[model samples]
Target: MSTMPTLDTPVTLTISPDGGIDGRSRRYEKFLGDMAGVYRDAEAWQAAVSARGADELVYWVDDHRYQEGPGALIVGTSTLLPGRIGDEFAVTRGHLHAIADRAELYHCLSGHGVMLLETVDGQSMAVELTPGKAVNVPGHWIHRSVNVGDEPFVTLFCYAADAGQDYALIADAGGMKSLVVADGDGWMLTPNPDHTGYRKA
Candidate 1:
């Protein structure tokens, strides 16, 4: 009599022992096709970005991730235009809103500037910032900066997070808007509105 297979010793067989190998291999081929499609899409995206010069020479740095949860993303742009002896630019200032996962940090790569930090209890202080210097803006603190130099100033800014996240909500705050600058006309605040090249010129 023929013996039946038991759980400890089961028989291994294919869908069809004769010629079903091609069909089995087709599934793997489809998976490879899907992966190739993803790679093509990524390559196309990089090409388009390169054509527009959107990611040109720029100082960009940020934390890898937050210790507790999500992290933060910080981005800054600087230009070296012709400037007089006392020309100043108010970059940004005011209440540091709490991010979901990360904190913010700033590193002054070039030029001279000042970071005015105010605590929740109404105490404020100005910290001098220079190239190669780094500052950590704690969660929920208010801060701002001013360029106090004669030449073109450059800065590198960054953000940290409890998790890997981007914290840009402060860009939408009311009092936090504008950079109060020490121009020839004394302290002047300018609206920090998002500008497009087509709209301005």
Candidate 2:
């Protein structure tokens, strides 16, 4: 068997101006109109978002063993585009931990946004995010983040190495029941009708 890398030296990770963790970083992009029915005005939003070319970006560390399970620690940053999807703002593709009891932690390093969380049993909530803010995601909840400001939303995340993300669970549920969007001078929290409950803006 191969030995693990020696820890005799400091392992340095660079954060790009946009909050990307350098060195073999992987990026996933989502255009503004990506999530079709997740918004109130689907067709209108799709046309508007597409015309603006707004896109969200998720940057992940290039370590190959993250999905291997057990002791692996996965960390990365998601830079949500500074725009809206109908009444919703730019957001990450949320996911539930493949290992049900695996929790995750997220630190907001830059920008303004909120972390939307929900459990399979119907509990839902949101945590506002600003520079230096951090939030914990319980193992039983599926979560995602939204950029509700005029600038890019960036946040760093850490989770158990063995905890894999189940994106289909979130997609199948039609996304979180609530959304964060720009509200004139600040931001607004609104409801996503696709999900069961309604949250007023």
Candidate 3:
């Protein structure tokens, strides 16, 4: 069910290439310590925490949601710092929308990245993104961002305001089916051996 805003006023936002959302309503951040079982290389992750300290910021998001109804939209930005845990790249703790069938758009603003997308029923894809490139992610697909460059990978994103995230989907499934990994000086998509398949939400 959708509800119209009581005050139907227009809102403007300034999105920066470095992942800043000037009119964002909220800011969320994740540190190395926040990722416990997110990485396949557990030992490598642990060693990284020991070496770089667990408080190191890995990624963050800034978003603006002006209304609360299903008809409303949330515009946001994601900034992911570059690093590697074994062959795996730095990633956002991915999710499927809580509504399950809500689509989203991600446009690269800076640096390089890969949109790792997978379906609950074994379908998968890895799409590389650079400045000016975007991916229209269809509904029912779980998605995560991977930073494979030396600089911060930033993106501008927009989706239905009512489409909330279910972040535990990937963790519960033992991670996504495909991983965006290092391949020489470039990147590649490889199967995640530990994935036990998604448990439909």
Candidate 4:
């Protein structure tokens, strides 16, 4: 079973006004309360990162089980380093397992890239993404992104589902396969019986 990260504990703060406080002082007190809330939220986010570790941004769960089952929200951000000359990652055609929920969304935080998206029925499309652009991956659709520019690719990923459920799972086409490695010469692709084909970059 995959070890899931624990949710951050909540923090609460309360402020009481004094009977003799002036209007400006009251306003300042309110501002302090607001700042406290912001600090609490940031602390919670940091705790989550500490529990999950920084590597979750790039760790690929190649061939793993969805221990949380289905329908859970998993929010994360990821950054991909620049590929060496002639380096490539071949992506296989597959569908996300969480079909009952809304589609997964990816917002590009920086860099330039293209994502190949295909329907379960074989229709294909490509989306060009740059900084500040967002793309929604329809549930059960086959999609993969490739960095086509010189810089490292960065993105904010949001997967929505019920608590304690798997955020996403890849369903491979009949025979399609993919390889992600540092060496450019190690990748290859093949045709799948389910009407999808894989290619190496």
Name the best candidate (by lDDT). 3
Cα RMSD for candidate 4? Answer: 18.0
What is the per-residue lDDT of model 2 for residues 9-103, given as tens digits with 9 covering 90 to 100?
33466765366767533655565546655555678666875676546332223232234456666677767767665666767778788887899
After superposition, candidate 2 runs with Cα above 4 Å error:
1-10, 53-67, 196-201
TM-score for candidate 1: 0.40
Q: Candidate 2's C-alpha lDDT?
A: 0.69
Rank ordering of all candidates by lDDT, starting from the highest? 3, 2, 4, 1
Give me the runs in candidate 4 sitting further than 4 Å from their true place. 1-72, 84-95, 98-102, 161-201
Q: Report the CA-based lDDT of candidate 1 relative to the real structure.
A: 0.40
lDDT of every model, 2 decimals = 0.40, 0.69, 0.93, 0.42
Q: Per-residue lDDT for 100 in model 1?
A: 32
- The count of backbone overlaps in candidate 4 is 1
**Which ranges in model 3 have alpha carbons more than 4 Å from their true place?**
1-5
- Candidate closest to the true structure, highest TM-score: 3
Q: What is the C-alpha lDDT profile of model 3 across 10-117, one tens digit per residue?
A: 988989998888888999999999999999999999999999999999999999988887789999999999999989999999999999899999999999999999
Give per-residue CA lDDT, model 1, range 1-201, as digits (tens): 999743332223233211122112122111111211111133543453456343332121121221233333424333222122123342332335454324567666666666765443434566676677878876555665555554434544455423233223333332333334565734454443431111100
Greater-TM-score candidate between 1 and 3: 3
TM-score, every prediction? 0.40, 0.79, 0.96, 0.45
Winner of 1 and 4 under TM-score: 4
